[model samples]
Target: MNAPPATRGGSALVVIDMINTYDHPDADLLLPSVRAALPGMRRLIGRARDEEVDVIYVNDNFGRWRSHHDELLAGALRGPHADLVAPVRPDGDSLFVVKARHSIFYETPLEYLLAEYGIGHVVLCGQVTEQCVLYSALDAHIRHLRVTVPTDAVACIHPDLADAALRMMERNMAVRLADSGSTGLFG
Candidate 1:
């Protein structure tokens, strides 16, 4: 809500697409990968809140561009994964960004939000490591924001794809990859 300019690299924690649309098999295979990161994401959320760092839920609008972020969260919360998201939740202190496209940056206020806070670094923790997660990481790299994807905090449809995505991100972009246990020094 407060979009004031900042001098420091305001650290931000991004929780991406942990939705019911991904979890329920009838919806898609999105749950498997997302579920894998739940524990780590819960940890990150607490750490970020404790450190006074911004917590942003960068989720998909499921292509419904005009949808409200809260509505999507409501829908997800009402679904089968209600128990899963009960712990990792949003409050008045958090920011929620709903994207219609794969990348949070594609036709969204993400860039403005980052710039306003001078978030030169973003701790990426979310679902679908191969899709939205990958795209967001790429966008962060292009914007020169330092990016870190906690290995255990992100998940992919397959282990191989997840490994490949992390490896490629490390090689091609200026990204730092770490397991959840190792990233304790950050927040």
Candidate 2:
């Protein structure tokens, strides 16, 4: 497949489904991985901000149709794992997009937002590498956006599935697989 035309604007860091309440099924299984990935996520977010890159958080809405970004954040922060949510909480300047399903772009304004920002590349991070992250990467790829996923920055419920997902992303979508400390990630 041909690459999408490059945009003049720089890369954006897209945080997917990380601002979570962890109240659902499989939460127990996912928590350990989330804990392990926290530091990497923190580093990437810090670097993205330091580099003046747009930090866009695209999260699942948990079926709260009337809720907004702040509400979702507040709920997550109030959950049992507030410690986890606090470190990567969205700042005042961070862009927020609410998603209903697996893919960040599904029925969301993310495509328009990226276009408005002239973003041609997206660095994806956050939970469920085999699910949300994987689907989001595919969506970004088809949309012609260059995709990157820092392996260490994504959490997964099942390690084996997550590994397969990462490999699929790299092989099929041409996604750049890097660690959170990789330089120029936001370039």
Candidate 3:
């Protein structure tokens, strides 16, 4: 994983809270949005891979302090949205960061990892756009990382809330609002 960085100025793709068990109360509400964004997520992921951009999965620990990445994947695969998890499962080459909170950088080595690779730009994609995505974007901004969130690649429970969050990100953090197709990782 210590290879030279890819993409312009060491950019990375951060996937947040996608490997979920969907056993919670809000699971049903979130599922539809996730399904809607699945294709875009897949496209962005493929582009990142093809462009040799770093892919990082910043997933919630789900209160499992000792749980590993495989355990989380297995749990999600056994629950709802197995289809989603199966297709987007992190491969051996992908990096995984177990986050306990909404922000990926909070209590995680994400900052150091990005810094080690000299990654200054992050393209965020995954579930719950209004919460995890919003918070992580803010945290990224605070850390001086150029943030970009492909709107179609992120899922949210409420469309209105998602729009508002995206607007806030663009206005406050100066985050680049883009779609999977408009994101030019290689170019």
Candidate 4:
């Protein structure tokens, strides 16, 4: 509810599933890749803030029925990669959207919120590039929102699958795989 609700006809950055505990089955393998993405993600976040672009963190609720955003954040801070969590943590002005599914727009108020904010374009940056990020991008595309995925800002569980997912998004969803600095949406 922060940041004036929406920026309609503007751009927003959705950080998906990054506030994770990394205690899942594939976590060990995914942690390193996710860490590698921190720099890019941080850079993008900084740019978004500087440009006054909406920074929306669409995180998983970790299946906790009553868990709130702050709780999820605190849990992640206590997780293995607290360093990763700290630098990209959402600020007071940032928007938070708690989701139970992969896609940010799935059964969530993301679509409605974006519409209210007048966000016609979205730049997605976060973990599990092949899963949540991919699904969210597709959902955005279908919703007719201009989608941009900063390649370096998204992490993956498997390199091969991640690459394939990027290609699929590019070809099918018309996603643009770019560097965080070149996203252009911020400027």
Best by TM-score: 2
Write the residue-wise lDDT of candidate 3 on 79-187 in tens digits. Answer: 8579888777887878999999999999999988997877889999998899999999999898777899999999998889999999999999999999888847523
Give every collision pair in model 3: none
Tell me the TM-score of each prediction against the true structure: 0.87, 0.96, 0.93, 0.94
State, as a TM-score between 0 and 1, how close model 3 is to the true structure: 0.93
Relative to the true structure, candidate 1 reaches a TM of: 0.87
Model number with the top lDDT: 2
* Tens-digit lDDT string for candidate 1 (64-138): 667786778788788777866777878898998877788878888888888877776788987778877888999
lDDT minimum window of 10 residues, candidate 1: 19-28
What stretches of model 2 exceed 4 Å from their correct place?
1-4
Error of 3 at 136 (Å): 0.3
> Which consecutive 10 residues in model 4 have the weakest lDDT in total?
1-10
* Candidate rank order under TM-score: 2, 4, 3, 1
How do the residues 1-187 of candidate 4 rate in per-residue lDDT, one tens digit apiece? 4233234468899998888888789988888888899999999999999989999999999889899999999999998778889999999999999998989989898888888788888999998888999999999888777889999899999999999999999999998789987846553
Count clashing residue pairs in model 1. 1
lDDT of 2 at 79: 92
